[model samples]
Target: MTAGEPDLVGPEILDGHLYDYPAYYDLVFGSDCAAETAFFEDCFRQLARRPVERIFEPACGTGRLLYRLSRRGYSVSGNDLNPHAVAYCNARFERAGWDPPAVLGDMADFRLRRKVDAAFNTINSFRHLDNENAARSHLGCVAAALARGGLYLLGLHLTPTRGPRDMGESWTARRGHLGIVSNLQSISIDRRRRVEKFAMSFDVYTPTRHRRIEGILEYRTYTLEQIRRSVESVPSLEWIETFDFAYDISRPVVVGNLTEDVVLVLRKR
Candidate 1:
């Protein structure tokens, strides 16, 4: 009913990797698919040096956004490390009578058959690189896959310049007979190592069963300076603009010490 409000319905608790449950994961994150697609299209129109058509996504869990973009006639392709998610995405495309585009691959090192007009990886997925070399390598791969002047919209949370702190968020979403109450919290922060650990739990409600799925994950932390350096490490990509999670193209924000959620628009040189 409200943010972080506990559900009244009791659920059977279980520990599991969230990515393994593609259907439930989609329900939690796919609710805003349309809006996010619109924002990406606007970004391409407003910032890309060439007309945007072909698109790519690294770590495209469940292929929700890719499917949405494909329906809008944009050539969309994506890769993910999860076999379940890749299978789920392909099945979804087949059920829709469209050609499947999702493939199994890693985010830090992968290539495309052809260069795309734009690429994106959002919602702090980039932070999973876990180190400077991996982060820079991923950027290099994206740059190599993009046509000259193509845009790569990378979204993630930046560590506060003052210091790291424990924080959390929660939300609820429902689709037909299924509902999801999701909670995500930062369990640990190592400023020296530039890493943060998170615990994510989802209370899933269905007609036949109710279960709580929990997962622990680690993400590499980046300050404003650190991210700037990472971008600079990739010679082909230039950091063009910065926006918050609001996905507003008109309102570019200067990333600073206090900035948390950041969406960086990188252009391939």
Candidate 2:
């Protein structure tokens, strides 16, 4: 049940495109503004006021948040199920003069030897659970990690109302240093997978040439209602804030929707 190099996965990178988790993340999000992203993560930590002695990111691909938190004076540790990701994190930790937290099996249900003061799922990471039961199990996992009053912060998403949405795609580049891609992503749920599939057919082209270096990234989504229902089942779960991403409009967006996906700050009761 260990997650190490032999068990990790990276992009086969066949047919001119495709990478495993780290390659996929580097390609998709591009190496841009990592500090900015980390700032928000620290914001969550500050908001929760939890002394994050040991932190866990279930989907810590390439150690994005883990790396940032470590740089910022936190004793950070994490587990990424993808072997490629886990390997990358281990290397990063070694280079940083730290011992990488051993990655256990799947995020759906994992048990760490050490208890943590806080844990989080940021940037819609919680949507990976795919089904209701798995999400609930993970929520319980979070509760078990806490010390009676530990905090769990999640930047989750609500169900997107179906429509064209003027969804467009675009890509940008930065001379020879790096390339940037901003594209329209359409995410829809498949009842069979119980997971929302985000379809991206965009490419990051070389600077000035505008030739497409093929990048295909697909991430399945899970709904906020599913998260709420799951977390509620945990005996000591308590939800404090319900932040909205409504863009300051009159009412909420999307029909048949009753929940606002927010940075759910949960305290183990």
Whole-model Cα lDDT of every candidate shown, in order: 0.89, 0.58
Clashing pairs in 2: 8-83, 9-84, 10-20, 11-19, 11-20, 196-221
Best by lDDT: 1
Q: How does model 1 fare in lDDT?
A: 0.89
Instruction: Work out the TM-score per prediction.
Output: 0.94, 0.70
Lowest summed lDDT over 10 consecutive residues: which window, candidate 1? 1-10
How many pairs of residues collide in each model? 0, 6
Off by over 4 Å in 2: 1-24, 27-50, 102-104, 160-176, 180-184, 187-195, 205-225, 244-261
lDDT for each residue of candidate 2 in 216-256, tens digit (9 for 90 to 100): 34444545555556778997878765443321222323423
User: RMSD in angstroms, all models?
Assistant: 2.4, 8.5
Error of 2 at 19 (Å): 6.1
Q: What overall lDDT, based on C-alpha atoms, would model 2 receive against the true structure?
A: 0.58
